[model samples]
Target: MNTENRGAAQPPEPARGAGPGPAGAAPLVDPLAAVRAERDPAVDVYLTGTVFLDIIFTGLDSAPVRGTESWARGMGSSPGGVANMATALARLGLRTSLAAAFGDDHYGEYCWDALAQGEGIDLTPSRTVPGWHSPVTVSMAYEGERTMVSHGHEPPPGTAPPTPRCPPRTRAAVAALTPGEPAAWIAQAARLGTRIFADTGWDDTGRWDLAALPDLRYCEAFLPNAEEAMRYTGTDCPRAAAHALAERVPMAVVTLGADGAYAVDGGTGEAAEVPAIEVAALDPTGAGDVFVAGFVTGTLAGWPLADRLAFAGLTAALSVQEFGGSLSAPGWTEIAAWWRHVQRYDDQNPAALRRYAFLDGLLPGAGARSWPLRRAVPTIGFGRGT
Candidate 1:
């Protein structure tokens, strides 16, 4: 997006004359300093919506036919949806908790274990609903895109129990508002002064309900991808669509897949856009969710909006290079490690370094370069060098 900055060995500052952009922050000199946050129970982020056992199939040859069979070279089963966002938040070192109903079935146990133990996410407020089968999503990834089919059963009214109480101190939540799903809880959370970061799922019926606009007033932030924003605002332009949606909420962030992202901060009456980090995407399944995770992390840290968007873009870019949905999210370890790896290369090769130039200003110092050398080198003796 900003090639000059991308290849200049330092990330660019928010351009001054950029049309209708948010106020600028100096180019992030040390990203860690720009985003210094802590684990505060009173201001932590809460993730909701039931977990799904994402059975991801990758390296597919072609789309499966109606009466034909297909095969994928790789497959991985991991947490999806809420877990996707939750894991990404935890990986970003955020104080995160999840509140949702889960099935007592095998899939439920798998997801619970993955989120609670594997990702170190707080699940104390989440419960398992008996007899309700766990949600399962079968994702087929090919050519940098994913096709997902999910199955779940929603208990009828009076039968379905309420979501377990979220952490008493939660300050924010990530949830979707569909037709039949609860909207009252959003108001309840709002009453508690929780900053709700809301997003909507795809509307298959093509009826982008205008009534839902009122529901968003309860949320502090509304994040939707370009297509979703366009569909809701009835405007194909991402910028106009973002400003249009900004009218209904405090902040409207429209995530443009490759074109990066656009946002309007109603609080400051400022709108800014940032470009996406270029990467060879392997599986883009949960990139959007990860982007939100980074954005929320930046918001909680009080970072500049431009920095938030850039960090989010980087997070999503790293995610696409890996396969599974939630499992693919990069932790701080990866970020720091890559920052060091990129520094070894010369700035003279700007085109080659452009991809990593942003890290120069963000990561603190040249992180530990390599592991300590061991006296005894273990070699299987496959080659003469051993």
Candidate 2:
């Protein structure tokens, strides 16, 4: 798709509750009318915020001691956060675009190349900082766990570049923020008639004001990992944290590393518990980003909530099997096939399978649900059961 003409077509109108609308008639305009008035394009996904260059170093036995040097078996660079999600979505056959800032440095160029050439993601409105340092993360993987050390400051504000050539069927916008200008960016996307999905970065914890929650309340989904949820909602339990967040947002999902995830609609009491995909995790760097990509893609494709969770879980499981973030991300074809096979075999024990399916769907595909079946298909080579 052409990146130049995408978001440059027209200016967005004021959203319904921005201020007073049409006189005494309630002041607020009808949301449906506004949606219809906007040209609902075929843009599959708009990803904004948290674009970074991730340098992954794999196969470490322990943290680097003061003077000791560890053998670095593997190293590679890939897109991080929202950028990673955009690329994953594009690889899964979605029309995706990225809106973020990058420095004019070599690191920024590397990030741009990964998103553009490597994943075919469009970068229309992405800004380039003339003399700024682009964000970078150094991730170290040991056993199955990983730790990240980040560098660089947030990108400076500037007029967004023209939109690129994108698909016309615009569906959802995923915003990954590290506590910088999230409210304004989110509002802008919302004005364009796109649903918003939010993910908080580790650095955003104490940096941004929580009061911004009210402004972000209109978001369709709010995704935060277990620790971030606890920090944001002031709770220890993932479910409680999700509930706290849901009180302000429409929907909330808290990802619990190996435990899985829990989602709830603050508007309703409905909730779903998803389990983690069981895999011999090689690296956990971009697992959450992959999960967000899969979930958003499934949701935009009209998959049921259960199916969405399943897809997200499966994608994350596949991601851990490889070293770099995007390298291990599975395509839609792989995810669909795995889901179908798991469903077929799960039919054996009706009652037990139903509950297992519900829990497994939470983990990605049936990585955890297919544990016992692993012995049946040893060639697939998923690790021992969870």
Candidate 3:
């Protein structure tokens, strides 16, 4: 296992010489430009978690057979785990800072460079541990689902440079709440006036008690899937679950897979829902992370609850059409292209198009990159040069 430490220094300027680094990369148009404040937070979003090197195999007809050799038609690899959400936020033009550990091995070096240089994420708070091998997850995707097997051990105790006691003061932070294991930094960041948006993984313990998550009180919004919201709230319907959850947090967003998402604002008793966009899904790896990033962007820009839901759903829908987790995240260029493409379809429902008509004023001028921007190569190790 790798150990991580935080530093007070700011992110270094992007390196100059590189085949595809942050240097000279055109900045995406900021969706929040109109709301820019003279005293804006130094960072738009801040998050800390484990980073995993994800190896994904796609284009499989079904789950692997027990006694036979199975082959996948396609494969891709990239930084994953918390990196998924970090990359998603960065791609959407949010100033994202990530605090995590990286192994000293080749995989770790590749992952670090990919995030810091390629994605332009701030890593001053991150550290590298000597002799630690990067954790890895082998994922198989088929039928819009995925099965993953991961392996890694925690860093032995007494390692140099422990986790940071205080995180940077950012506009917002995303926390993954786990039962019985509270993150101390969540409360600290909250006290510093950072809006907290949180999500949860499946509770394998079968105990969905809301009491287990003591840090929920500090959060401004809580996003959980349909099943998770229903289980935690003991509600028969997802919309009801959202309402129940809203009583705990100011806002509750419930994601219903193909049906899209529903959200409720307890502060104002506002409710909104958006249908999912139809597209051929190549991989559903980082769609959830993308969804949260979109919502955060809209929220920080002061968008309405309904528009937030719609934008979140639209971003997730676009991510499923690609492969990998972090690399599959779409940028503003992709969003602009999709908006233009849909506008050409005159037969489409006017209401549906009007729902997203707001993008017309927010989108940047046409960029040089083509639609469906070509993503990074499936695997690392093409020599660090290019």
Per-candidate Cα RMSD to the true structure, in Å, reads 12.1, 12.1, 3.1
lDDT of 1 by residue, 274-311 (tens): 77767777678788888998888777667778767877
Q: Choose 1 or 2, whichever is better by lDDT.
A: 1
| The candidate that achieves the highest TM-score relative to the unseen native structure | 3
Which tens-of-lDDT digit does each residue in 265-382 have in candidate 2? Answer: 7778678877776777767877888899878866666655666776687778877766666545655334444555556764455643454353243224212222222111001123
**The 10-residue segment with the lowest total lDDT in model 2:** 372-381
Query: Model 2 misses residue 267 by how many Å?
Result: 2.9
The candidate maximizing lDDT is: 3
Native RMSD of candidate 2 (Å): 12.1
Give the number of colliding residue pairs in candidate 1: 0
What clash pairs does model 3 have? Answer: none
Steric collisions counted per model: 0, 23, 0
Candidate 3 has an lDDT of: 0.83
Candidate 1 lowest-lDDT run of ten: 1-10
Better of 1 and 2 by TM-score: 1
lDDT of 2: 0.63
